[model samples]
Target: MKSPSVVMLRRNLKHIARNPTSVFNAVLMPVIVMLMFVYMIGDAFNVGVNYVDYATPGLLLLAVCYGLGSVAVSVNSDMTKGVINRFKVMDVPRSAVLTGHVVASVLTNLIAVAAIIGVAFALGFNPSASFMQWLEVIGIVVLLGFATGWLTVALGLFAKTPETAGMAAIPLIMLPFFSSAIVPADKMGPGLREFAKYQPFTPIIETLRGLLAGAPAASDVLQALAWLVGIVVVGYLWAFASFTKRA
Candidate 1:
Protein backbone atom coordinates (compact mmCIF):
# COMPACT_ATOMS: atom_id res chain seq x y z
CA MET A 1 0.00 0.00 0.00
CA LYS A 2 1.23 3.52 -0.74
CA SER A 3 2.03 5.76 2.15
CA PRO A 4 -0.79 8.20 2.72
CA SER A 5 1.29 11.34 2.17
CA VAL A 6 2.85 9.96 -0.97
CA VAL A 7 -0.55 9.05 -2.35
CA MET A 8 -1.77 12.58 -1.73
CA LEU A 9 1.34 14.08 -3.29
CA ARG A 10 0.88 12.09 -6.47
CA ARG A 11 -2.79 12.96 -6.64
CA ASN A 12 -2.02 16.69 -6.21
CA LEU A 13 0.68 16.63 -8.89
CA LYS A 14 -1.70 15.02 -11.35
CA HIS A 15 -4.39 17.57 -10.68
CA ILE A 16 -1.99 20.51 -10.99
CA ALA A 17 -0.59 19.14 -14.25
CA ARG A 18 -4.03 19.11 -15.83
CA ASN A 19 -4.44 22.88 -15.41
CA PRO A 20 -1.19 24.50 -16.42
CA THR A 21 -2.68 28.01 -16.64
CA SER A 22 -3.31 28.14 -12.93
CA VAL A 23 0.21 26.83 -12.51
CA PHE A 24 1.45 29.59 -14.78
CA ASN A 25 -0.17 32.29 -12.59
CA ALA A 26 1.52 30.72 -9.60
CA VAL A 27 4.84 31.21 -11.43
CA LEU A 28 4.43 34.54 -13.23
CA MET A 29 2.53 37.02 -11.05
CA PRO A 30 5.07 37.07 -8.24
CA VAL A 31 7.88 37.51 -10.70
CA ILE A 32 6.16 40.50 -12.22
CA VAL A 33 5.61 42.13 -8.86
CA MET A 34 9.21 41.49 -7.89
CA LEU A 35 10.40 43.09 -11.11
CA MET A 36 8.15 46.09 -10.60
CA PHE A 37 9.44 46.71 -7.09
CA VAL A 38 13.03 46.21 -8.19
CA TYR A 39 12.77 48.76 -10.97
CA MET A 40 10.35 51.32 -9.54
CA ILE A 41 11.97 51.45 -6.15
CA GLY A 42 15.48 50.35 -7.06
CA ASP A 43 16.50 53.84 -8.06
CA ALA A 44 13.57 55.91 -6.86
CA PHE A 45 14.30 55.44 -3.18
CA ASN A 46 17.56 56.00 -1.34
CA VAL A 47 17.31 53.40 1.38
CA GLY A 48 21.14 53.34 1.82
CA VAL A 49 21.31 49.71 0.61
CA ASN A 50 21.37 47.97 -2.73
CA TYR A 51 17.75 48.08 -3.88
CA VAL A 52 17.45 44.56 -5.25
CA ASP A 53 19.04 43.18 -2.12
CA TYR A 54 16.58 45.14 -0.01
CA ALA A 55 13.64 43.97 -2.11
CA THR A 56 14.54 40.29 -2.43
CA PRO A 57 13.24 39.18 0.94
CA GLY A 58 10.07 41.19 0.42
CA LEU A 59 9.64 39.54 -2.95
CA LEU A 60 10.09 36.15 -1.33
CA LEU A 61 7.39 36.98 1.18
CA LEU A 62 5.25 38.23 -1.67
CA ALA A 63 5.68 34.82 -3.24
CA VAL A 64 4.15 33.34 -0.10
CA CYS A 65 1.22 35.75 -0.43
CA TYR A 66 0.72 34.79 -4.06
CA GLY A 67 0.80 31.09 -3.24
CA LEU A 68 -1.67 31.39 -0.37
CA GLY A 69 -4.09 33.50 -2.39
CA SER A 70 -4.07 31.03 -5.22
CA VAL A 71 -4.53 28.14 -2.80
CA ALA A 72 -7.61 29.79 -1.35
CA VAL A 73 -9.11 30.30 -4.76
CA SER A 74 -8.39 26.75 -5.84
CA VAL A 75 -9.69 25.21 -2.65
CA ASN A 76 -12.80 27.34 -2.80
CA SER A 77 -13.36 26.31 -6.40
CA ASP A 78 -13.06 22.66 -5.39
CA MET A 79 -15.54 23.09 -2.61
CA THR A 80 -17.95 25.19 -4.63
CA LYS A 81 -17.97 22.75 -7.55
CA GLY A 82 -19.02 19.85 -5.25
CA VAL A 83 -15.67 18.16 -5.75
CA ILE A 84 -15.05 18.23 -2.00
CA ASN A 85 -18.44 16.62 -1.46
CA ARG A 86 -17.46 13.85 -3.83
CA PHE A 87 -14.18 13.37 -1.96
CA LYS A 88 -16.07 13.09 1.31
CA VAL A 89 -18.28 10.36 -0.13
CA MET A 90 -15.30 8.52 -1.61
CA ASP A 91 -13.83 7.96 1.85
CA VAL A 92 -10.58 9.77 1.22
CA PRO A 93 -8.49 10.45 4.30
CA ARG A 94 -9.23 13.98 5.44
CA SER A 95 -5.64 14.70 6.36
CA ALA A 96 -4.54 13.46 2.99
CA VAL A 97 -6.71 15.93 1.16
CA LEU A 98 -5.30 18.84 3.15
CA THR A 99 -1.72 17.64 2.88
CA GLY A 100 -2.07 17.16 -0.84
CA HIS A 101 -3.05 20.78 -1.24
CA VAL A 102 -0.28 21.99 1.03
CA VAL A 103 2.34 19.99 -0.85
CA ALA A 104 1.07 21.35 -4.15
CA SER A 105 1.28 24.90 -2.80
CA VAL A 106 4.89 24.40 -1.74
CA LEU A 107 5.84 23.02 -5.16
CA THR A 108 4.13 25.91 -6.90
CA ASN A 109 5.80 28.52 -4.69
CA LEU A 110 9.20 26.95 -5.26
CA ILE A 111 8.72 27.44 -8.98
CA ALA A 112 7.78 31.07 -8.38
CA VAL A 113 10.83 31.55 -6.15
CA ALA A 114 13.13 30.17 -8.84
CA ALA A 115 11.68 32.53 -11.40
CA ILE A 116 11.97 35.46 -9.00
CA ILE A 117 15.62 34.60 -8.32
CA GLY A 118 16.32 34.81 -12.04
CA VAL A 119 14.64 38.21 -12.20
CA ALA A 120 16.60 39.33 -9.14
CA PHE A 121 19.80 38.42 -10.91
CA ALA A 122 18.84 40.34 -14.03
CA LEU A 123 18.12 43.33 -11.80
CA GLY A 124 21.69 43.07 -10.35
CA PHE A 125 20.97 41.53 -7.00
CA ASN A 126 23.81 39.53 -5.47
CA PRO A 127 23.42 37.17 -2.52
CA SER A 128 26.28 37.11 -0.05
CA ALA A 129 25.16 34.17 2.05
CA SER A 130 27.08 30.88 2.21
CA PHE A 131 25.63 27.55 1.06
CA MET A 132 24.08 26.98 4.45
CA GLN A 133 22.52 30.41 4.44
CA TRP A 134 20.98 29.63 1.09
CA LEU A 135 19.55 26.46 2.55
CA GLU A 136 18.19 28.41 5.51
CA VAL A 137 16.44 30.79 3.13
CA ILE A 138 14.84 27.87 1.34
CA GLY A 139 13.82 26.35 4.66
CA ILE A 140 12.13 29.55 5.77
CA VAL A 141 10.31 29.85 2.48
CA VAL A 142 9.06 26.26 2.66
CA LEU A 143 7.85 26.46 6.24
CA LEU A 144 6.32 29.88 5.76
CA GLY A 145 4.55 28.80 2.61
CA PHE A 146 3.21 25.68 4.32
CA ALA A 147 1.89 27.67 7.25
CA THR A 148 0.28 30.18 4.93
CA GLY A 149 -1.35 27.31 3.04
CA TRP A 150 -2.94 26.07 6.23
CA LEU A 151 -4.30 29.54 6.91
CA THR A 152 -5.59 29.82 3.37
CA VAL A 153 -7.19 26.42 3.62
CA ALA A 154 -8.93 27.50 6.76
CA LEU A 155 -10.20 30.60 5.00
CA GLY A 156 -11.35 28.55 2.04
CA LEU A 157 -13.26 26.15 4.25
CA PHE A 158 -14.91 28.82 6.36
CA ALA A 159 -15.91 31.21 3.62
CA LYS A 160 -19.38 30.80 2.16
CA THR A 161 -18.26 31.47 -1.39
CA PRO A 162 -15.19 31.91 -3.60
CA GLU A 163 -15.73 35.67 -3.70
CA THR A 164 -15.84 35.76 0.07
CA ALA A 165 -12.56 33.89 0.18
CA GLY A 166 -10.90 36.66 -1.80
CA MET A 167 -12.31 39.33 0.51
CA ALA A 168 -11.30 37.44 3.62
CA ALA A 169 -7.77 37.13 2.28
CA ILE A 170 -7.04 40.85 1.92
CA PRO A 171 -5.76 41.55 5.43
CA LEU A 172 -3.44 38.53 5.57
CA ILE A 173 -2.22 39.27 2.07
CA MET A 174 -1.47 42.89 2.92
CA LEU A 175 0.40 42.04 6.13
CA PRO A 176 3.92 41.73 4.79
CA PHE A 177 3.84 45.18 3.27
CA PHE A 178 3.10 46.81 6.60
CA SER A 179 5.75 44.72 8.27
CA SER A 180 9.43 44.61 7.31
CA ALA A 181 8.84 43.58 3.72
CA ILE A 182 9.60 46.79 1.81
CA VAL A 183 11.22 48.98 4.45
CA PRO A 184 12.73 48.55 7.89
CA ALA A 185 10.29 48.78 10.77
CA ASP A 186 12.27 51.52 12.44
CA LYS A 187 12.08 53.70 9.40
CA MET A 188 8.32 54.07 9.46
CA GLY A 189 6.41 56.65 11.49
CA PRO A 190 6.17 56.18 15.27
CA GLY A 191 2.71 54.60 15.38
CA LEU A 192 3.14 52.31 12.36
CA ARG A 193 6.67 51.44 13.44
CA GLU A 194 5.48 50.35 16.86
CA PHE A 195 2.84 48.11 15.32
CA ALA A 196 5.31 46.53 12.90
CA LYS A 197 7.85 45.71 15.58
CA TYR A 198 5.47 43.58 17.61
CA GLN A 199 3.65 41.67 14.89
CA PRO A 200 4.53 38.09 13.78
CA PHE A 201 5.57 39.24 10.33
CA THR A 202 8.41 41.45 11.59
CA PRO A 203 10.42 38.59 13.01
CA ILE A 204 10.00 36.45 9.90
CA ILE A 205 11.02 39.30 7.64
CA GLU A 206 13.87 40.20 9.96
CA THR A 207 15.11 36.62 9.94
CA LEU A 208 15.03 36.58 6.16
CA ARG A 209 16.88 39.88 5.99
CA GLY A 210 19.55 38.74 8.44
CA LEU A 211 20.06 35.55 6.47
CA LEU A 212 20.32 37.41 3.20
CA ALA A 213 22.72 39.96 4.67
CA GLY A 214 25.00 37.23 6.07
CA ALA A 215 24.38 38.37 9.62
CA PRO A 216 23.81 36.12 12.60
CA ALA A 217 20.30 34.75 12.97
CA ALA A 218 18.45 37.06 15.30
CA SER A 219 16.87 35.78 18.54
CA ASP A 220 13.64 36.65 16.74
CA VAL A 221 13.75 33.32 14.92
CA LEU A 222 12.29 31.66 17.99
CA GLN A 223 9.45 34.16 18.07
CA ALA A 224 8.73 33.65 14.41
CA LEU A 225 8.60 29.88 14.88
CA ALA A 226 6.30 30.32 17.86
CA TRP A 227 3.98 32.45 15.78
CA LEU A 228 4.04 29.89 12.97
CA VAL A 229 3.22 27.11 15.39
CA GLY A 230 0.36 29.01 16.98
CA ILE A 231 -1.12 29.96 13.63
CA VAL A 232 -0.84 26.44 12.29
CA VAL A 233 -2.60 25.02 15.32
CA VAL A 234 -5.48 27.47 15.16
CA GLY A 235 -5.70 27.28 11.39
CA TYR A 236 -6.01 23.51 11.40
CA LEU A 237 -8.65 23.70 14.08
CA TRP A 238 -10.70 26.09 12.03
CA ALA A 239 -10.24 23.99 8.94
CA PHE A 240 -11.33 20.84 10.76
CA ALA A 241 -14.34 22.60 12.25
CA SER A 242 -15.41 23.89 8.86
CA PHE A 243 -14.80 20.56 7.20
CA THR A 244 -16.94 18.76 9.76
CA LYS A 245 -19.71 21.30 9.52
CA ARG A 246 -19.89 21.00 5.77
CA ALA A 247 -19.36 17.26 5.60
Candidate 2:
Protein backbone atom coordinates (compact mmCIF):
# COMPACT_ATOMS: atom_id res chain seq x y z
CA MET A 1 0.00 0.00 0.00
CA LYS A 2 1.09 3.54 -0.63
CA SER A 3 2.10 5.61 2.37
CA PRO A 4 -0.28 8.32 3.55
CA SER A 5 2.34 10.88 2.59
CA VAL A 6 2.37 9.63 -0.99
CA VAL A 7 -1.41 10.01 -1.20
CA MET A 8 -1.14 13.51 0.21
CA LEU A 9 1.54 14.27 -2.37
CA ARG A 10 -0.82 13.39 -5.19
CA ARG A 11 -3.50 15.61 -3.69
CA ASN A 12 -1.01 18.46 -3.46
CA LEU A 13 -0.03 18.18 -7.11
CA LYS A 14 -3.67 18.32 -8.08
CA HIS A 15 -4.23 21.44 -5.98
CA ILE A 16 -1.12 23.05 -7.44
CA ALA A 17 -2.27 22.30 -10.95
CA ARG A 18 -5.61 23.91 -10.23
CA ASN A 19 -4.10 27.14 -8.92
CA PRO A 20 -1.22 27.96 -11.25
CA THR A 21 -0.83 31.59 -10.06
CA SER A 22 0.92 30.42 -6.93
CA VAL A 23 3.54 28.73 -9.07
CA PHE A 24 3.77 31.85 -11.24
CA ASN A 25 4.54 34.01 -8.21
CA ALA A 26 7.28 31.55 -7.34
CA VAL A 27 8.93 32.66 -10.60
CA LEU A 28 7.71 36.17 -11.49
CA MET A 29 8.47 38.09 -8.32
CA PRO A 30 11.98 36.71 -7.99
CA VAL A 31 12.71 37.45 -11.61
CA ILE A 32 11.57 41.03 -11.14
CA VAL A 33 13.85 41.47 -8.15
CA MET A 34 16.73 40.00 -10.07
CA LEU A 35 16.21 42.42 -12.95
CA MET A 36 15.82 45.39 -10.64
CA PHE A 37 18.93 44.68 -8.62
CA VAL A 38 21.22 43.34 -11.31
CA TYR A 39 20.23 45.54 -14.20
CA MET A 40 18.80 48.70 -12.67
CA ILE A 41 20.84 49.36 -9.52
CA GLY A 42 23.81 47.00 -9.51
CA ASP A 43 26.35 49.19 -11.28
CA ALA A 44 25.73 52.03 -8.84
CA PHE A 45 27.06 49.87 -6.00
CA ASN A 46 30.17 48.74 -7.89
CA VAL A 47 30.44 45.58 -5.75
CA GLY A 48 33.49 44.34 -7.79
CA VAL A 49 31.64 41.28 -9.11
CA ASN A 50 29.39 40.81 -12.08
CA TYR A 51 26.06 42.01 -10.74
CA VAL A 52 24.12 39.13 -12.26
CA ASP A 53 26.57 36.59 -10.97
CA TYR A 54 26.45 38.02 -7.47
CA ALA A 55 22.67 38.37 -7.49
CA THR A 56 21.83 34.99 -9.03
CA PRO A 57 22.19 32.82 -5.95
CA GLY A 58 20.63 35.43 -3.70
CA LEU A 59 17.68 35.87 -6.04
CA LEU A 60 17.27 32.11 -6.32
CA LEU A 61 17.06 31.94 -2.55
CA LEU A 62 14.67 34.86 -2.68
CA ALA A 63 12.44 32.81 -4.95
CA VAL A 64 12.23 30.20 -2.21
CA CYS A 65 11.53 32.94 0.29
CA TYR A 66 8.83 34.41 -1.89
CA GLY A 67 7.26 31.01 -2.45
CA LEU A 68 6.55 30.79 1.28
CA GLY A 69 3.96 33.55 0.91
CA SER A 70 1.69 31.10 -0.81
CA VAL A 71 2.47 28.41 1.72
CA ALA A 72 1.27 30.56 4.62
CA VAL A 73 -1.83 31.71 2.78
CA SER A 74 -2.75 28.13 1.86
CA VAL A 75 -2.24 26.89 5.39
CA ASN A 76 -4.16 29.82 6.79
CA SER A 77 -7.01 29.21 4.39
CA ASP A 78 -7.15 25.53 5.34
CA MET A 79 -7.19 26.38 9.02
CA THR A 80 -9.83 29.06 8.70
CA LYS A 81 -12.04 26.82 6.56
CA GLY A 82 -11.58 23.98 9.05
CA VAL A 83 -10.11 21.93 6.25
CA ILE A 84 -7.15 21.09 8.45
CA ASN A 85 -9.40 19.94 11.27
CA ARG A 86 -11.28 17.72 8.87
CA PHE A 87 -8.01 16.20 7.72
CA LYS A 88 -7.16 15.45 11.31
CA VAL A 89 -10.51 13.64 11.72
CA MET A 90 -9.74 11.44 8.71
CA ASP A 91 -7.46 8.38 8.90
CA VAL A 92 -4.85 10.18 6.81
CA PRO A 93 -1.36 10.82 8.14
CA ARG A 94 -0.93 13.96 10.21
CA SER A 95 2.47 14.95 8.90
CA ALA A 96 1.59 14.10 5.31
CA VAL A 97 -0.61 17.13 4.76
CA LEU A 98 2.07 19.63 5.71
CA THR A 99 4.83 17.61 4.06
CA GLY A 100 2.88 17.53 0.83
CA HIS A 101 2.51 21.29 0.88
CA VAL A 102 6.23 21.68 1.51
CA VAL A 103 7.17 19.31 -1.28
CA ALA A 104 5.04 21.30 -3.69
CA SER A 105 6.57 24.55 -2.50
CA VAL A 106 10.11 23.22 -2.98
CA LEU A 107 9.37 21.93 -6.47
CA THR A 108 7.68 25.15 -7.50
CA ASN A 109 10.61 27.16 -6.23
CA LEU A 110 13.03 24.90 -8.15
CA ILE A 111 11.19 25.80 -11.34
CA ALA A 112 11.47 29.46 -10.42
CA VAL A 113 15.17 28.96 -9.78
CA ALA A 114 15.49 27.59 -13.28
CA ALA A 115 14.02 30.75 -14.75
CA ILE A 116 16.34 32.84 -12.63
CA ILE A 117 19.30 30.77 -13.87
CA GLY A 118 18.20 31.29 -17.45
CA VAL A 119 18.13 35.03 -16.96
CA ALA A 120 21.48 34.87 -15.22
CA PHE A 121 22.99 32.95 -18.10
CA ALA A 122 21.65 35.47 -20.60
CA LEU A 123 23.21 38.24 -18.51
CA GLY A 124 26.60 36.47 -18.83
CA PHE A 125 26.67 34.83 -15.41
CA ASN A 126 28.78 31.78 -16.04
CA PRO A 127 29.87 29.19 -13.49
CA SER A 128 33.49 28.34 -14.26
CA ALA A 129 33.24 25.43 -11.82
CA SER A 130 33.20 21.71 -12.63
CA PHE A 131 29.95 19.74 -12.99
CA MET A 132 30.24 18.47 -9.40
CA GLN A 133 30.67 22.02 -8.16
CA TRP A 134 27.50 23.13 -9.92
CA LEU A 135 25.66 20.18 -8.44
CA GLU A 136 26.88 21.12 -4.97
CA VAL A 137 25.55 24.65 -5.37
CA ILE A 138 22.18 23.44 -6.60
CA GLY A 139 21.99 20.99 -3.71
CA ILE A 140 22.65 23.76 -1.19
CA VAL A 141 19.99 26.03 -2.71
CA VAL A 142 17.40 23.22 -2.65
CA LEU A 143 18.20 22.49 0.97
CA LEU A 144 17.83 26.17 1.76
CA GLY A 145 14.43 26.13 0.10
CA PHE A 146 13.33 23.19 2.25
CA ALA A 147 14.61 24.83 5.43
CA THR A 148 12.85 28.06 4.51
CA GLY A 149 9.61 26.26 3.70
CA TRP A 150 9.69 24.54 7.09
CA LEU A 151 10.05 27.89 8.84
CA THR A 152 7.04 29.26 6.95
CA VAL A 153 5.03 26.16 7.87
CA ALA A 154 5.56 27.02 11.53
CA LEU A 155 4.51 30.62 10.91
CA GLY A 156 1.33 29.53 9.15
CA LEU A 157 0.32 27.25 11.99
CA PHE A 158 0.93 29.91 14.64
CA ALA A 159 -0.51 32.99 13.00
CA LYS A 160 -4.12 33.96 13.65
CA THR A 161 -4.93 34.45 9.96
CA PRO A 162 -3.36 34.14 6.56
CA GLU A 163 -2.69 37.89 6.40
CA THR A 164 -0.80 37.73 9.66
CA ALA A 165 1.12 34.72 8.44
CA GLY A 166 2.24 36.62 5.37
CA MET A 167 3.17 39.58 7.53
CA ALA A 168 5.23 37.37 9.80
CA ALA A 169 7.06 35.92 6.81
CA ILE A 170 8.25 39.38 5.77
CA PRO A 171 11.10 39.35 8.26
CA LEU A 172 12.30 35.95 7.18
CA ILE A 173 12.24 37.15 3.59
CA MET A 174 14.30 40.23 4.46
CA LEU A 175 16.88 38.47 6.64
CA PRO A 176 18.96 37.48 3.62
CA PHE A 177 19.75 41.13 2.84
CA PHE A 178 21.78 41.51 6.00
CA SER A 179 23.93 38.57 4.97
CA SER A 180 26.79 38.66 2.46
CA ALA A 181 24.44 38.44 -0.48
CA ILE A 182 25.02 41.73 -2.29
CA VAL A 183 28.30 42.85 -0.76
CA PRO A 184 31.11 41.44 1.32
CA ALA A 185 30.38 41.36 5.03
CA ASP A 186 33.85 42.63 5.90
CA LYS A 187 33.21 45.69 3.74
CA MET A 188 30.41 46.78 6.04
CA GLY A 189 30.98 48.57 9.34
CA PRO A 190 32.33 46.64 12.29
CA GLY A 191 29.01 46.17 14.07
CA LEU A 192 27.11 45.25 10.89
CA ARG A 193 29.90 42.91 9.88
CA GLU A 194 29.79 41.21 13.27
CA PHE A 195 26.06 40.65 12.96
CA ALA A 196 26.23 39.44 9.36
CA LYS A 197 29.17 37.17 10.10
CA TYR A 198 27.14 35.31 12.72
CA GLN A 199 23.78 35.37 10.97
CA PRO A 200 22.43 32.07 9.53
CA PHE A 201 22.31 33.25 5.91
CA THR A 202 25.95 34.33 5.88
CA PRO A 203 27.62 30.93 5.94
CA ILE A 204 25.08 29.54 3.54
CA ILE A 205 25.61 32.40 1.06
CA GLU A 206 29.35 32.17 1.52
CA THR A 207 29.31 28.48 0.78
CA LEU A 208 27.36 29.05 -2.42
CA ARG A 209 29.59 31.93 -3.50
CA GLY A 210 32.67 29.81 -2.86
CA LEU A 211 31.31 26.94 -4.89
CA LEU A 212 30.19 29.22 -7.71
CA ALA A 213 33.65 30.75 -7.86
CA GLY A 214 35.15 27.24 -7.94
CA ALA A 215 36.80 27.58 -4.55
CA PRO A 216 35.86 24.89 -2.08
CA ALA A 217 35.99 26.06 1.50
CA ALA A 218 35.44 23.39 4.11
CA SER A 219 34.61 25.74 6.96
CA ASP A 220 31.96 27.56 4.96
CA VAL A 221 30.31 24.36 3.74
CA LEU A 222 30.20 22.91 7.27
CA GLN A 223 28.79 26.12 8.68
CA ALA A 224 26.07 26.28 6.03
CA LEU A 225 25.13 22.64 6.63
CA ALA A 226 25.04 23.26 10.37
CA TRP A 227 22.60 26.11 9.98
CA LEU A 228 20.41 24.13 7.58
CA VAL A 229 20.28 21.11 9.94
CA GLY A 230 19.55 23.27 12.96
CA ILE A 231 16.68 25.11 11.24
CA VAL A 232 15.05 21.91 9.92
CA VAL A 233 15.19 20.10 13.26
CA VAL A 234 13.94 22.97 15.37
CA GLY A 235 11.35 24.19 12.88
CA TYR A 236 9.91 20.73 12.31
CA LEU A 237 9.68 20.08 16.05
CA TRP A 238 7.73 23.28 16.60
CA ALA A 239 5.49 22.70 13.60
CA PHE A 240 4.73 19.11 14.71
CA ALA A 241 3.77 20.20 18.20
CA SER A 242 1.59 23.01 16.91
CA PHE A 243 -0.17 20.78 14.40
CA THR A 244 -0.79 17.93 16.83
CA LYS A 245 -2.09 20.07 19.68
CA ARG A 246 -4.13 22.68 17.87
CA ALA A 247 -5.14 21.40 14.46
TM-scores, one per candidate: 0.90, 0.92
What would the per-residue lDDT of candidate 2 be over residues 194-246, giving only the tens digit for each residue? 98899999888888877888996899999999999898887788778878776
lDDT of 1 by residue, 51-162 (tens): 8888888788777776566577767777788977787787777788777788888888888888888898898888788889989989988888778878888898888888
Q: Which predicted model would earn the best lDDT?
A: 2
**Candidate 1 wrongly placed segments (more than 4 Å):** 1-11, 14-21
Highest TM-score against the true fold, candidate: 2
Prediction 2 global C-alpha lDDT: 0.81
Model 1's C-alpha root-mean-square deviation from the true structure amounts to 2.1
Clashing pairs in 1: none
